[model samples]
Target: MLPALALAVAVTVTAPPAAHARTGPAPSAAKASKTAKFPPGFLWGVATSGFQGEGSFPDSNWTRYVKRKATGISDPYEKSVDFLHRYPGDIKLARNLGANVFRTSIEWARIEPRPGVRDPKAIAYYDDLIRRIRAAGMRPMITLDHWVYPGWVADQGAWDNPKTQADWLRNARFIVDRYKHQGVIWITFNEASAYMYKELTMRPMDLGQLAAMRTAIVKTHRAAYDMIHKIDPGAPVSTNVAYGTALNGIFDAALFNEVTDKIDFIGIDYYYGANAENLTAGYALTGEFWKIDPEPEGLYYVLKSYQRRLPKLPVYVVENGMSTDNGKPRPDGYTRSDHLRDHIYWIQRAMADGVKMIGYNYWSLTDNYEWGSYRPRFGLYTVDALTDPSLARRPTDAVATYRSIIANRGVPSGYVPVRRPGWCSVEDPVATCFGTTPTPPAAYRIPAR
Candidate 1:
């Protein structure tokens, strides 16, 4: 177990602390009367994007990042993970673990790189992928846009110009119409706000460009939702908004929130929370490159924060995980499984307190691309993007842990942690003591570069 570096913030209300309560009626009556399973009929799965794992066929915003060498990407944009070929093995990987649901994206750049020219070849590829997922006996969750846009569209001013909305919908409508039969869950965009940073900053974010990009995403999401429902009334359509600072632009959540009434289940992707220090550094809290706070309580507070604003909807923790290079041991010898166990315990704790968190999806099934570098590994099945031509996927210990949890429907009874994390305080819904204690300057996090 790792030793927690404690930090604190002042609270406006000096309130009493809260505790985690077990759910269900009493065990004697609970077994007979328990309304929900430990997972409580909630789904469990993982998420991946087309460009990140699907590998190369065309250039888009992401390929530009690699070719221009904005960050350190050495490969020739070759089929890196080659999930294009390995999805059968990958979906099999998912099913073996008993994961009932899996989320992946439909890359627009691949399907519609040219104006009015739909790529039958690329559509056929996804057609095959969706069919395989059902064959695996797992529900497919599809993300219409996972950050990559067609290269030609990028040249047409990208998100800076509102014209991108028309192009985005063309691709969105094409995908939903083609694959609606899968009985799948639909997420219109991957993480709109975080991409505003990616589209701007990796290209670099200026205030003007950032604002325009955010607007385009909201407009794009609404258009996609309408088009999807139009095609398949049975398809539950929605978009996954990656929660950014203060649980997604505290005030600006309305950009995505406006369409809440139109969505089915909310896919809320939470990688990490931004304490005041993280915001000062200027990186969007999209990927789990840094362990901002490894405490499970942060998960509970974030889930509820969104719930208060978007109540009457069941929330799914769509994407969550820690990134490790080579799965190296953590500061005090914590392994990946420890991270999984702690975070999930907090998830169950959230369920106990009635957050209505419907599912848990790990960030990825295989280590693929992380923006421009292969250094940040978030997959349960690690793929070393360097020195391995086979693109062989290997499973980590966390897989077995997760498999058992899924198979048994919950963590084993009487299971306890090696140490109690300090952030546990946040899980208490009433006392959500944010920044309630003084954090030492020396302990300020050295975030991922």
Candidate 2:
């Protein structure tokens, strides 16, 4: 997930040439017909992380970070959504969406609060969580690390310490051995680049320390991939990348490139997009994600780019969603339902164009603590983690839209996007705008319902 804090990293923006203007009529109904169906057995799911969604967090780097009153956290981390206790009901909510997958992470801090000490209670909690997810007829996609480490680990310099690799592997082996029989898909790391960036944001790191942390992340992912496969043969494992628009190649080179041979699938987490006409992604610099315009059509280009690079591996959209300010209506009048449908439309288009797309998990099931703030809401069911006493999971407009999409395996046949494709998308400017990329079926906009 993109960090909900000011990002110091610079984005490389490429200005498209003037000749790339969108032209031509909408594709014939015959061409657009292919966008209505998905391949059989595509996984549909919702995603949440241990630190972000599951509250009652154990002693970890994040818990410690939030404790610093100057972090500018919008709301105190008060048992965020309390998924630690409310997971049963949450699982039922996901199952109701007709989803076949449920993605989440195991809190390393909770499981191993001390060096070499394993918490039985934490193990039991995760065991029941996985069992309940399976009972609800959804496959569990478990992430080994979601950017939080045991406070003890932090006391010893976190990932900058060379010994941390062994500790991380030990935890990975334990989790894999315990859950291998639960039919769980494994995610070795979540948004490794973003993880590194978040670490830098919290505390400045020297170049050597940054290098050490990067090496640790790469080595551990490669090691974890092998260990997971050995424990659960044929199990799929990947480290999802937070898709960085024009700098994707450079950002991925840090960790993703090192373990290309190890990943079973290409996991991508795409949110905002940039182009000549749309540059609102800058809002994320100040953690104002809701102000960023979502370019759903850019998903098609992102998938295409990955398919070109690693044609053998299937692509799974591990996270994708639009945020709203405190669950309020968007100024652009773009509802969650509209955003969901538009993104799915592009996914289908990508599949139709022969990208080996396998699955897509919405960013979250309910609004939880987004790194440091509760202001950027990205959930099908909105929960007021800061203001509401009961922490109710109020269904957003996207709930029914998602249920319908899953039931039919895609959007309705004649449905058109509420938002038109942006001109000269930075996701893949050369291919999407300049190169001989075939023109997309021209969009026919319909009033958002």
lDDT string for model 1 (1-449, tens) is 00000000111112222233322221111121112236556688977888888876586878888888763444556676898888889999998888889899888888887877878888888888889888888889998777788888888888887778887887777778788777788887776655554654567646666656666777777777778888877777776776544333432342455567777777776655533222321232334364444444356566655666566888888888877755565665555676676567656655665678778888889888887667678889998777688888888888998887777766554444332334213233234333333323333232211
Candidate-wise lDDT, in order: 0.66, 0.81
**What is the lDDT, from 0 to 100, of the residue 389 in candidate 1?**
85
All candidates: TM-score: 0.82, 0.91
Model 2: lowest-lDDT 10 consecutive positions: 5-14
- Pairs of residues at least 3 apart in sequence or in different chains that clash in candidate 2: none
Query: What are the root-mean-square deviations of the candidates from the true structure over C-alphas?
Result: 7.9, 4.5
